[model samples]
Target chain A: MKPFPAVLKEKKRYVIFEIISEKRVKEDAVKKAFFREIKSFIGINGMADAAPTVVYFDEKSKKGVLKVDNRALKQVEQALSLIREISFNKCFVHIIKTTGTVKKAKELVKRGD
Target chain B: MKAFIDFVASEDCVSFGKKLGFSRLLFNELSRDKISKTKINIISPKSPEESKRQLRNKMIDIILDPFDKRGLFIDSAFLNIAKQKQISIGISFSKFLRADENSRIRLLHNMRRLTALVSKLKGDLVLMSLAAEIYEMRSPEQLILFGEMLGLSRAQATWCITESPKGIIRRKSL
Candidate 1:
């Protein structure tokens, strides 16, 4: 038999998760939890997509930058300020950004945190 | 054996030093007196694994109060150790560890960069030591976790000594 070539395989992926945040992200602990989970996936060299995603603040089409940080616990403070009320009449909106594998996107969507 | 002294005692790190027979110097005295910030330094560990472990343990404390009314609490003992060791002080000092959003934002940004660095390392953990001369400060907990999230083990673990000049050290050390 001719030389057998061994091919190694690893599942690498990039996924962007956008959430209409069922509730305005005003809880620091909740946001911290969200990012903390993200942290686990961030540095995996293989079988993972480690890239920084841009957080876009969208209201009335006015956009600014939001940093995803463990310190952004004040998101609750800010969310509390902006949330006049939350009711179950409308759909939560989110746009998954340009990225990688479908499996990654599914993983992000499955994250209830 | 010679002993090291810390003038700032933002936390029990000084007491820990005392237990070790390194003279307990409260950092508050130096910071309160408006002492020179440049007096101390540290020699850090070459292993990233150690720094990461310290960062993980201390970060639990830092994130406890990332932004609070009391602001960050810092101890000079960590700084003095860095100085005594003659090590290069790397990242993890807040230029202004304060409650203000502007300062906190910068601190958060730097913290992100640090965590990113930690994520990249090949070591089991990355370690770091910080030195702050102490001024009006911010949440010490945030400072601790920010380092922790980035893989700093213990801010003082790497160094063997911290130097505090006599008379300036602190009465609390007594």
Candidate 2:
């Protein structure tokens, strides 16, 4: 099997966001809530376009890195911004920054500590 | 760098707004004699008629949200008057963020209408957190993104957080 060429491949973006919540949210709960909101907002087809994944998340820092399709970056952001709560606890997810690489996104998240 | 201004519902989010990088945070309290000692004045009228009355008052830096208590009262006439008065039409992000799924749909419908009219009239539309709690406070970029979601162009959305609010602050001088 051969992978697609760079031009044919979907360009990716890393979004670093911090969840400001009253209590520490488990990574699983965060992932669940995140995908649910994205799916609900953008729908299945849009989710496929986004191709989002939680690449890294720190429970203590409440910061996480999400990998998504570059073209659907704004759609992912809209979903994250509209997230008012997760696991029944009120919270707000603020995008610290978006970068082209996961390493850079992780570094930005680490610097927030 | 553009100075970002946000309007908050209570005194609690003031410290949080500072942490979020907002240069100014207007505390919207009806009974406040001078807005806040440090913050600018903001008014949220209960009805379109009341909004018309508040537009005459020079003390108000921004007409926080033009809603008739339970419903939005924004129309071309209201926006034109607001434009003439130099009073920025504020759209609080928390209002939509706080609504349930059913009401959120209705709210979005109304907000889109407001956005189209404001853009058509070239009115000053200020987007604020108006967060009652610390967690409710969103970053300036997030507010700008939310503005874009509300049927505003990217540049127009950026203006809501940057130039629009700055104009109100400059006029009020606080």
Candidate 3:
């Protein structure tokens, strides 16, 4: 049998944001603001072709997948689901930054959103 | 007199769909509890696995069609047996809820496939306990992604923080 080459992996990067609001209604608005921030400032240049982004939500923390070449997104979301964050109301979204180009992982991370 | 639907055969799904106003209701009577909500059942002479295999085979007959073969329109012909059904779709995490490393890796692949399928559908949001799941998704980001996949300009995608069972105002993401 031909040996399978180890899949290329990329270094991970994260984008964080906080929109201050005393109002509960502002929570949704703030999240939208953050998405706009990422897309306009970072998502377009870094993740134009990206889909299947897995966004995780917990009590005040969030995670999402921006882009990845061969990264498994569903497992990330399911793994997040296994988290017992049912305790915390606020949450996070974790995005797998995959270009499947491990060679460019650092460069991609450095180009901040 | 208020016009109502009557079942000449039985009070099964086609009748229920007429009553409920949805042309079809997504359901899989995998168990008795799943059927309890709907008040109907489809008993097969074959065992569950055998029946599932048979059903899958029948589905593949249609799924293999060159033009009409989008997996989104999966065949749940027998799924119509339940009454008062509200599309009881399950997101199984049995694989991901594991401690072994290899299994965890496998679970991720399943999730990626799931994400892609749901993201691709982009329409057909399920009305859930608290909110409308645009494409079987549970996260705000996916709601946005599905919205955009359906070509919602960036501004049209909106995510409400609270999970409310009250009927959602927007059927699809803006």
Best by DockQ: 2
**Docking quality class, candidate 3:** incorrect
Tell me the tens digit of each residue's lDDT in model 3 across A1-113: 87556553343322222111222323344345334433432336444432323232222423222332233333222233233122233322323343443235434434432
What's the iRMSD of model 2? 1.0
**1 versus 3: better DockQ goes to:** 3
Q: Rank the candidates by DockQ, best first.
A: 2, 3, 1
Instruction: Report the lDDT of model 3 for residue B13.
Output: 37
Off by over 4 Å in 1: A1-113, B1-86, B90-96, B114-144, B150-174
Interface RMSD of each: 15.6, 1.0, 10.5
Where does candidate 3 stray beyond 4 Å?
A: A1-113, B1-31, B37-101, B111-139, B142-174
In candidate 3, what are the lDDT values of residues B52-171, reduced to their tens digit?
A: 443433111101100111222222343332111222111222223323444544444433443344335431122111111111113334333433433333333331111111111122
Where does the lowest 10-residue lDDT sum fall in candidate 2 chain A? Answer: A104-113
In TM-score terms, candidate 2 sits at 0.88
Per-residue lDDT of A1-113 in model 1, one digit per residue for the tens?
Answer: 66545443332333233333334443333334333334432324311233223343333222212233323322321221111112322111122332245454444444431
With candidate 3 superimposed using the best TM-score fit, by how many Å does residue B65's alpha carbon deviate from the native? Answer: 23
Q: What is the TM-score of each candidate against the true structure?
A: 0.23, 0.88, 0.25
Candidate 1 local lDDT, B1-174, one digit each (tens): 434433333554444334323443443322213323333322122244443333333111111112222322222343343234322223433222322434554555544443343234311111212223222121232233334443444343222123212322221133
